[model samples]
Target chain A: MSAPIQLRPDETFILNVGPQHPATHGVLRVKMEMDGEYIVKAETVLGYVHRMHEKMGENRTYAQYLPNLSRLDYLGALGYTHGHVLSIERAAGIEVPERAEYIRAITVELNRVASHLFWFGAFVMDLGGFSPLMYAIQDREHILDILEGVTGSRLTYCYYRFGGLYNDVDDEFIEATKRFIPNMRKSLKKYAALVTGNIIFHKRLEGIAPVSAETCRKYGATGPVARGSGINFDVRKNEPYSVYSDFDFDVPVYQEGDSLARYKVRMDEIEQSLRIIEQGLAKLPAGPIMTEKKPKNIKLPVGDFYQAVETARGSFGIRIVSDGDKNAYRLKLRSPTYSNMHLFDETCEGMLIMDALAFMGSLDLVIPEMDR
Target chain B: MGGYFSDIFYGGKSLLVGLSITFREFFKPTVTVQYPYQTIKMSARFRGHIELLADDTGSPKCVACGMCQRACPSSCISLDSVSVDIEVDGKVKKKKVLSRYDLNFTTCSLCGQCVENCNFGAIDFSKEYNLASTRKEDFHFDLLDRLKRLEEKKA
Candidate 1:
């Protein structure tokens, strides 16, 4: 638990939201100074789930550190893994096969959809709607099944290798993904009817916690958090990686900058992700999954390298400083949630406690990712 | 008065729409898998734990090369190899044989590095996922003994 927030006696009192509360998502403690159910001040205390992943990267070999990437954000593990792999690939000058790049794009997009689907359920659950959570998870299960068929693990997938994929995607995976697109579209329609059109849901979210584009810029928030403020910046389009440039998809933006805007951004992103997946499946070419000239022991050149990828939450960047050794001299994981959650201190002030919690939910703070 | 009535009407309509969605889902097939009784079949590619492979002579194919021990990222694998004098083709020769092979499953990340580095195909991920133990030491498995027991079962 964090130290009690300083407040004048009888004027305000301290309230600790979590480090154990389910609504905080993970072990996140928010020390709030409250005045009659209104937050006077708030501070988010992190590092509960810190695994020293960066230190692990320094000690372990480049290839050995790959598994740690998934543990950071288990829901969006592949995106982190992809960013790590891309960084190493760029640093080591490894050429990935075209088919492998296409496969990575498709699987990553599918993973993004799954992550957003989970967030949708969990966010609605945070708002006291349980039925939407069930529906969202039921739809997300199909994604897990398809990803499991190819990647082997349902959640913490260590599927992406440095230069290519761990294994090839069979026809069954492609067929299942193709079937999933239409099914997801139909579900989205139902979600709109069930949750989106519901007046209660709108009243809870609409115009609550309006984060400006300036606030997003100041905090360096990316993904839906930034896009909801109408930033119009997506790493896939702005700084293209893998085969993302080859595909065409819209970067959904909403100008209201409220919790509802963020929700709409994520929901629209699911549709766009589906489009990217469909395009990737259609354009997927047949080639060797792994590069022929893969080095048995991965060693990067003595230089610093950075790679950024658009994850479901936001932009995940990996920076590696290598001294031409097997292990990194310094490895920094630029987690998006950390930056996005930083705005909480300023944003939560003077707001009602329930709305503040709803705002926290909108940020989609994965504690481990922020702590790491 | 009309505006208030329409507001009520629209609110009721939206509430009804949400109710209808839940009602439709209620009658549909249950997605919950009754665990411990009805288990979903794990895929063939599911990674559980590393197991040693045996040869036709009912001996482990691991040549005491220590490749897997070196390749393990988590340092969870440890083995003791002993150099023994063996008679082969009526000639005495020294051969290194695995005396003890232990794996700390508590720390193992199931990264498949050890399996990939093994040239002899001596190790693979077994598809046994229902792992529950009361004591912590139960996770520390002796693969050599497990392999011998597997061989005995095969024989």
Candidate 2:
């Protein structure tokens, strides 16, 4: 549909891309000023799925707010849960067991792989390749199976507690994770052969929508999007939390800053996740999963506390303001996709509508995460 | 002419390589589990919904502590209990007996907060996941009656 706007006397039109369009990944509407197929300017309208999670945090106790973390990013729910738990633990001075830290690392990395797999499928599907989505989901189901074995739910897992996990993972979970790493490696090789080397896919993506490192810094785009622009800033390595410093892995970075570069960064991150999972499995200690002296009732000191963790998309930050009460005085969630999506207004200018959609896919937005 | 033909040859080779990968996977077993007709078994830890756990004496282990009701984020669980006089160790003692236990599955997040805070191990998640119903009333369940029926069936 065309909206009558007085941009020029020539053939200039306005188009609305979503709020309901399947290509949007969620309920996100992008208004574009288009001359034929090119986007002159683009603006994103948000708050479609906002459920006031921050207000809910102020109403409920810290423990009760655990389930809301999963609702933020269903694809990588554990990372948000981990962030919330770590922030509260730091504020309350709770010590987590070493084994529980290792378990958290392993499960979070497994969730990262699953998130990237879903993105891989959806990104290709956005590019009009249908077969890769089915293949990617098939691989992702294995990760879900391993996670469901211990976390009790596959997606939107409310598994982690303040000091440790709710339940200790069984030997079968370890065995399943050990089996998954090599299987995932074999699948990565297959994906390289199938999708990466295709000329048509490369032609559409390579050297298109190059975001400079400065733009990333301005927008606070941290994950693979920033990494694609050769910004080697990952929260895990920079501000090492949990047992992340124990694992030896590489953060993949590409200098091209194109859609393909971002795509390659995520593809390579999958391999690094597999490496982290393998190392975590080997280093998993035999001990209590939870700390012995956890507080029955959680009340933080009268101060502001913040925790940031690297999720599948980018850095996920949680800020809690407490007056030493059962409920939070104020809670703020800084989601990665929200920051990453902001760059669209600056980046989509002078690009074709098709390439703009591809660029959106490359950013890997989970709309609920952004809206929340 | 030579450069154009060479480009075509390179493209064809890459296309063939891509096709070969797909062709190899085409012969492999399909990954789909064909749901409903051929259901895959859920894992042991699959969280479906909250259910009251029955004790060895064929009654709910819940002491009517009201802890789960208070701890629930959505206010989905409600229990009605009355104090009754019972003989314990040759003495008259007043005990709280559960009259009604209502769990609104429609609003429940299955976050296991109720199960975790129960302390008495009186509640756990049931593995009944195929919960499609035509009527909205089917979701609101009376757990005390369900627990009694379960205990009777066990006996």
Candidate 3:
């Protein structure tokens, strides 16, 4: 690494918080200049886990590389899978069947719930609440079990096809999902009762790490992190890809712009996700899952297409510039966490060390996704 | 003096309230699952490793359609077809069959697209997902061997 930038006489001592630090979350290193835990300045250092996936996508055939989408943000693999498949179908001009759209919506929402649970657990852990971490993860395991049963994988599911789904939902799976809804609702209420009204949680979160709407927009923060600051932007609500338009659910937003607001936004989103899943299950169309029209083996028209999906953390956009080849000329993943993390430099300044970690936790910075 | 006394009383009351919440949960049923001994029941939709299944006739469900070979993102599947001679109903017959159908399981992301696309219901993903091997090639499976087992069961 280049020699540390020389600090002036009055400048603070620089502290590195690891690409390997457990608290930094997934191979992220933050360089902070601290005056005894009160940060004077901060910068996020990334690219530790960058695997050059976008370049690899171009060389592989369209069908040959759908699974690569899962590696980007493995926590919300369903969102990545859904986004890539939706974009490819749009690019190829293939129409997905009605049932496939509904299935996609249901599975993605379930994945969102799972992702939120994990975030809740991790965020609480960051605040030194260990029991809630275990409690949240225990609930999340059930969601994973459900996802793993249908997709035949967990964490990195490449289940969505270009125009449709790889597998059809059986009656048994649908019925089981019906059972999961009521149980999940109970879990959500339990979480609310457990954390929402807790004084300690409120004390740690309330009015802390407040990001104004202007600051959020300036930094291009999206997802709950942005929505917490009163920005009404959700790819599902705004863009309405897949069957998101069909489902009726409110996009929970809080204008408080505080850490508590961010936490509440995520909690409310879980409930909203459950609503979407319920609607999808009740009104799911029974028809062909895969489309009759097939995508070409080794071609995409020379054009650029930018597609965005509201992942659990934020809006994840994949920009592909195709020069009519098997591979993309340039593929850029606009990871929300990376941009959300940009605020860290400003937010951490003048905050205690523990507060800096709390601020980072509220951002929900998934380092692998950012590095990717 | 009055304000200080009031503050002390409220702080003590809230501490008791928070401690009560934790204490109540301590008596509640533990959510921890004893893994290995009591494996967490995988849902019907859970995704796991792909396995080739055999029928009563000991024939593999995989018709060598190559849908998986095409769908695979990692190019981990290797399949080749060959013709074989057989006797059926006292008559000589020649049939095309899968010579080689192997998957580099190490490279396989365990995405079920291959299993999802199989039209013959030949490939089934079992919940027996615990497979960690020393050699990379240990993940490979032969379709013919699985098929013969099905045929033997039928007889």
DockQ metric, candidate 3: 0.44
| Tens-place lDDT digits, model 1, residues A1-372 | 999878675798899999999899999999999998999999988878888999999999988898899999989999999999999888878899999999999999899999999999999999999988988999999999999998778898989887888889988898999999999999999999999988888889999999999999999999999999999999999999998889889999999999999999999999999999999988889999999976678888899899999998899999999899899999999999999999889988999999999999999888989898
| Alpha carbon lDDT at A53, candidate 3 | 79
| Candidate 1 ranges with C-alpha deviation above 4 Å | A1-10, B1-5, B86-90
* Residue runs of model 2 more than 4 Å from their true location after superposition: A1-9, B1-7
Measured over all alpha carbons after superposition, the RMSD of each candidate to the real structure, in angstroms, is: 3.4, 2.5, 4.4
User: How many residue pairs collide in each prediction?
Assistant: 0, 0, 18
Q: What is the DockQ of each candidate?
A: 0.73, 0.78, 0.44
Candidate 2: which pairs clash? none
Model 2 lDDT per residue over B1-155, tens place: 99789768877887898889878877898777778889988899999888899878777889899999998989999998899999999999999988889999998888898998988999999998999999979999999988888778777
In the range B1-155, model 1's lDDT, one tens digit per residue, is 99789878888999999998888876888778899889998877888889999888988899989889988889999999999999999999999898899999999988788987899999988887999999989999999999999888878
**What global local distance difference test value does model 3 have?**
0.81
The numbered model that scores best in TM-score is 2
TM-score of chain B of 1: 0.90
Q: Could you give candidate 2's per-residue lDDT for residues A1-372 as a string of tens digits?
A: 898765555577889999999789999999999988988889999989999988999999999899999999999999999999999999999999999999999999999999999999999999998888888999999999999999889898999998888899999999998888888999998888788987778878999899999999999998999999999989999999999999999999999999999999999999999999999999899999889976677989999999999999999999999998999999999999999999999999999999999999999999999988
lDDT by residue for model 3 over A1-372, one digit each (tens)? 899867676767889999788789888888988886688888888889988777787777766668788888888889987888877778868899999999988999989888888989999889887877777887787777777677767788878887788788777668778888888788777666667756677778888888999999999999999999999999999998888888899999999998999999999998899899999988998889888875546467899988899998899998888898877778778888989999888877788888878888988888778877
Extract clashing residue pairs from model 1: none
Interface RMSD, prediction 1 = 1.0
Best by the lDDT measure: 2
